[model samples]
Target: MHLPPKQGAAFDPLSEAFARDPYPAYAALRATAQPVYYAPFDIWLLSRYADVQAAALNPLSLRSLDHLMSADEMAEERRAQNWHDMPFHARFVQFSMLNADGEVHQRLRKLVFREFTPGQIERLKTGVATYVGGLFDRLGGPFDFIEDLAAHVPGLAIGRFLGVPDEDCPQLRGWSDDIVQYFDIDRTDARKALAERTTKTFYDYLTDLSKHRRRHPKDDLISRLIARWDTGELSEDEYISTCMLILMAGHGSTIDALGNGLTALLRFPDQRLMLSADRTLMPTAIQEMFRYDAPLPFFHRYASEDMEINGWELPKSTKIGLLYGSANRDPEAFADADTFDITRTPNRHLAFAAGPHFCLGNHLARLNMEAVFSQLLDRYPRIEPVTEPVFKPGLSLRGPKSLPIAVR
Candidate 1:
């Protein structure tokens, strides 16, 4: 398959070189008929800021996830390779708000939104504090930040949300890693099979936890979901899928953000120092980090009808991947778009996508990030990188796989 030029070459998403450093290629794309088309992937790449924003704004024209495909798109993209795969588990993404559209999307989102009420999120700070406290005590110099710290933040946070005990949070992290590979780059039959099995195990565990909660409800997300299910707003299938969605999407990107954001902070000591001097800048600093190194670079969408983007005509049902990563760094969107600046105002980065499919967990994710960075900056006067970071490959969600650093 054609891939982004390895090293400092053309933009190819499938190459390890691009995965390590994609910005140069993305920049090259920005300087051309970008996001126009990729012969290998057989999908349009929407890299321009306006086009990516347009896709997210017009979800009706460009869909997210399965929304199940309306039977027509499914028949068309059976390989599911074109952004509408359903082979793993029927309706696997069925109840997921990420995969729904219109009324169904609204309904699913409302159910979730209510559960994440402002009051509920505020109360979440206690658990977050506790997890961060424990994690900080054990972190020290000469450590793999991605594995030792960044990876655990989301796991512990989600564990508290899912009511998994502290001890089991580590195991849950493992299950999360194995199962989330369903969205990984280049899935072999072996990888797919392993992911399915891992997912089933994770799903079954949650199902049992859900059943137990039904018998004796608690103040956890699963219980809240069960409560909604009992009220007839959610089906058992929806209940299961929604729980999985929260467990996966909820924590996954935050972990990635922490890795990507912190790496950028370390690489740009000036910006990191600026944020340290003025804690109020934390919020904006995080925003800049997102724009600088978007956790996930692109979002997937299937063309709902014939449409034109940046002068390119896209036929109905065509697969499209919106390049938010590139857009965040587009010169037209941000002055010195490639530079890492925490003080950047009006930083409208598409790290979290936008419109109806705008990240539902944005508030929680921001809170978690702020909390983690606060602890890190406070504890370590210097977060020194011992080695170069490595990235996990995918057109979507991108982050460092390993970031070894020295904390002092």
Candidate 2:
């Protein structure tokens, strides 16, 4: 049965209401019999867990259309999507491993695979804890959790992993934010120019740092990657872009996860109290938080050939939007899905996504959450929100923009 995809007439992802709470709209999307065709992005949205996981695991579904589209076609498409005219972003941000598929993605991923494994990420635990403890010590009374605490943690943790100087992490966070904001729905000229300019500035900084690492090789990711470049394993562009991706991938997302996780705890006091009473639940609580509100929610996939998803036919080159956030909340996929429960077992959420393109820095992201929340629980016996947190408006990211809290 070749049924037509449902029209997503009521799905307005850019609306302020969606920004405040998208789960209701997501629920509507999931209730449809077939995938919904959202004309705004010309992409079919898959909200169900089964449909999304199947598409992600399917070899025909790709992150990039370059394999199926001609150069001219790609150029035109880029312009159509407002992704053209940015040189540095095109070179690095646009062409990075996140957008690559097949062997290229595998090769790029392989280069850094060992560095991000659970064991490798475990080594970073001490550094993350020490830094987080210092931040907690500096806090007094009511403070903006996102700005004062959450924002500062990821940059230092990921910066240390990539061998970035502690002083430079803050600037790198700003650069990452500007570059990533353009990836969302708003592609205004100002945002494009800002993304481009920031990329160039970021590129130059990495280039200089790479040079220094080459001369005085240290025991860090950059120094190690430098050896690979010297051995002709990585091109200059590849080397620089790889470093940029590592930093950008983990920076804001981790920060957002922290903020979202804290908000979840504050909202569900019982769950918070459960985890607080039983510290063993911290790890599970962290996982529940990511499942509850995935930071990087919306990602797209392109079908390289005709495919039938749950009996609905999708033609080649059809853009399929994977709503990971929605999938995480689907009632069919999770019992009591909407309820925030720290003790939920057998949780198989798609927060880090799945299949080949699963987030490489997932372990590190989880570790940061555990460290911060564990330290927070230990430090503050009582924590309350001073003001209600407002989520950033966009379909691409999810998190409280600023969360004011009082700790005693």
Candidate 3:
């Protein structure tokens, strides 16, 4: 019973309309087929649950973005970006593990995986409560939740988890912000250049800091990573790259999810009230937010060999965009999948992504959301939006740049 995958609408992931609200477009895509050949992005997009999972869990598939390229595409992008003139940007491309797989990813992920366990995240709950409590206490009026609360709180938690000096947490966030520009699918050469400069400075500073930590070991992730580096379990580049990646990945999505989650709660009053009445629902409620709207839109995989998805033959090295945002909302997977129901049982959405590269910081993110939103319910009797939330100008990530919420 193999029916042909339906033809999907034209998708422009970077278009302005897509950024503010992409679900409608995503819904259309999901209705069509399991995987659609989106010519605009030049990648096959998998919107169905089964297709997305297959792409995610298949070990033969490649996680590295570099795998999506042919040597010609690389040469063209190099000419387009003038990256060779920028040493640090070039070095970043070479060393980053985001696009690497196999032993490199394993070694890089292993160095810090022990300290990044779910149990460790559970332990950070107390610290999350403390940091968020003080932050909420300081808010006295109409506040930009994204800037004032969502952004800073995650950094504070990450700072504590990584053993960064409390004072340097804000500094770490600055670097996280800059490095995230690379994730922006629509970033210009100018912005990419700025991000590269920031990352170079960021890399140099952290490398020096890691050296200091190696000599004077501390109770932190970097200290532990340095220990492995000393024992020859990790390379210098891999160690430095992991430190940078963890901070960006750990801090960025959590901030977006927090902003997105709080906004969702405000929009859906019934669900909000339900959570407020029964605190037991916080876990499921957070899961709902993730499923309803993933903060990040897509994850990519490279075809290891010729493959068929939804009847489309993808040649080796073909770039595939696993549309996690769309997949989570597929009605085939969940009843009334578009609704924001906090009490969703067995809500196994691919918000953290799927398979080996599933988010390493998911537990920490959940802990932070629980800490902040629970306190938020008590802190504000009602939250009214001053304006429609303004999202950052990109399709790759979703979150308000500023969400002015009047607390009464």
Candidate 2 per-residue C-alpha lDDT over 284-306 given as tens digits, one digit per residue, 9 for 90 to 100: 89889999999999899998999
- Per-candidate Cα lDDT values, in order, are 0.75, 0.89, 0.79
lDDT tens digits, residue span 369-395, model 3: 888899999877788888998777665
Model 3 stretches astray by more than 4 angstroms:
1-9, 65-86
| Model 2: CA > 4 A from native | 1-9
lDDT of 1 by residue, 224-282 (tens): 77887889999887877777777778666788899999889988999899988899999
Candidate 3, RMSD to the unseen true structure: 2.8
Clashes of 3: 1
Error of 3 at 242 (Å): 0.4
Worst 10 residues of 2 by lDDT: 1-10
Candidates sorted by lDDT, best first: 2, 3, 1
Q: List the residue pairs that clash in candidate 3.
A: 64-99
Ranking by TM-score: 2, 3, 1
Lowest summed lDDT window (length 10), candidate 1: 1-10
List of clashing residue pairs for candidate 1: 3-12, 4-11, 4-12, 35-45
